[model samples]
Target: MSPQRPTNPAMQRLVDFYDPAVMGKDVGGRTLAQILAWRDTRLESQHDYIQVLFPLPEGSIFNEYSPVVDEETFLYLRHDSNDGFKRAMRRALARMLSFYGFDITWDQDAAGKWVVAVDAKKGAEEDHFPRWVRRMDHNHLRITRILRSLRVLGLEDEARAFFAALCWTFDSYRRIGDGSMKFWRRAVELPLHIAPDGTEVDWLEKYEEKKEEKAEE
Candidate 1:
């Protein structure tokens, strides 16, 4: 059966960009290029302004950066409640990962049950993809793009709820510092936008203010 478009405007926006015919195929060439362009443009715009605050390498290349996750992270998505949104987001995510040269695989248990797993499609050295980007904090470019895509697809609430569930059950990450914890909490509670000086802005507040002003008018 063909994938259905979402009723929500946000999800609908994403579905519009999505090519149902190419849904499960590899995510590369034009597909990956567009998103990478979006991600890189945003980061490059802030590079000069925020360099002092978060200095990355002098010249970094992150074109090969692929955000791969463990199998268990997708377990909750199997639930009936998240059916539509999960299907959409997972497919998009899979495409994104595939574009970055990740492969979809499965893990088989002793009893013969199998579950989804992610693997690097290439066996190249880490040096070739040295600028590995992980979901260490909200400053990540790739993750932000993924979430933005989901929101554009009209899965804003569903994506947020899924993220909350994932974070709550994250059993892999070790305890980070208090500062990082604080940043993570703030990032979660509000919509994030980077400032000229690399400070994180709560765009949600700005959005509400705009809505209120419009109401007043």
Candidate 2:
């Protein structure tokens, strides 16, 4: 039998979230479309590793997109019981994106429930990320950006908390996967290395390690 197509509605919502039309906005005086285009340029050699959480059936390419979260997480957040967490998460993401200068908005769907909405500040070029980078790496990049943004906004303590929670979450996930530990040492301890002048710190560099060590349960 052929592989059945994924008709999960939550997957569709995830795709919509990553759509260029929805993400087109001006960030930091430069259109998000423009910045995405820049990112695409940077994705030159890393192009083939981006994995799609929701891959369409063979030969069906319309509306294809990969979001930053997996399907299970997406559905969990969208479920009725989790709406409260969903709303808070939406606000958190919107706040982070706004700090990067993107104009984000939310809209009520046909069911009278609010969903994420985005608008561009100005017309700009198109942009896309390669298919090679999966959510694991994608999320790391996002966390790094959020940390840098928080530090820039003078919320160092909050940044540290967020970083700690994020690292703990990663540790939990890795531990669940194979009773391994990867992020605890370098990642969880990163904030301690911040320099007074902010010149000696390599925020992105150390965060790239993905080694998995056995965790002492």
Candidate 3:
């Protein structure tokens, strides 16, 4: 008999869990504890981010340009529960943001809660990318773009939830093989645009065209 494929209820649950308005509320409340507990109970795995080797081989010139990770730290994050991993990530991002003293806006209601917003941002950022491995800089850039876009759209909570999903997807890919890495590369290669219907458009195509226009100019 053929081996059966595991049912991916997690994927379905994740899709349902990512309601933009709901996510926004969670972020505004800074309810990471609740979110983490929810994810743990539903997903049953603590790992929320994934790791993959850069397309370039080790020791290649590109390797030097890529980001690096502390192997032990990466392993710990990979194996820890979702809550523990999120906390660790928050601490790391807090240290990085403290260097800049940046102010993060969690929501309109949180205007007075600078400390809370910062704490939440640090946690969210860390939770989204717990391990800083090589080739993961793109992941950060993607996340930063998502957050900025959310701010522009006034969808702070949705942005938080989206970032959470992104991190979760990344983690899922890491657990899978290099095939997952290839999938991410392909996904990123495709242009992402926002449609009038509130869907993603081929924004990358527009980006390429603008670059070409600039080159011609």
Backbone clash numbers for all candidates listed: 6, 6, 5
Q: Whole-model Cα lDDT per candidate? A: 0.37, 0.35, 0.33
List runs of model 1 lying over 4 Å from the truth.
Answer: 1-17, 21-90, 93-141, 148-153, 170-184, 191-217
lDDT of 2: 0.35
Query: What is the lDDT, from 0 to 100, of the residue 76 in candidate 3?
Result: 26
Q: Least accurate stretch of 10 residues (summed lDDT) in model 3?
A: 50-59
Tens digit of per-residue lDDT, candidate 2, span 1-217: 2222225654445333334455422212333334334443343343211222112111112223333333344334334554343343334444443322234555678999755444332421122111212234433444444454333322344445555544444453342221112332232344423422233334323322321122322
For model 3, residues 30-68, the per-residue Cα lDDT tens digits are 223344344322322322321111111111132232212
lDDT, model 1, position 54: 15
* Higher-scoring candidate on TM-score, 1 or 2: 1
Q: What lDDT score goes with residue 30 in model 1?
A: 33
List candidate 2 segments past 4 Å from native: 1-135, 175-217
Q: What does candidate 1 score on TM?
A: 0.32
lDDT for residue 118 in candidate 1, whole number 0-100: 48
1-217: candidate 1 lDDT, tens digit per residue: 3333344442333223333434321223233224434553354343321211111112123432222211222222223454554555565455544443345544678999655554455641242122322335433443334443343233445345434433432333333334433443443444434322244434334544654589899
Q: Over all chains combined, what TM-score does candidate 2 have?
A: 0.26
Q: How far is candidate 1 from the true structure (C-alpha RMSD, Å)?
A: 13.4
RMSD of each: 13.4, 20.3, 17.4
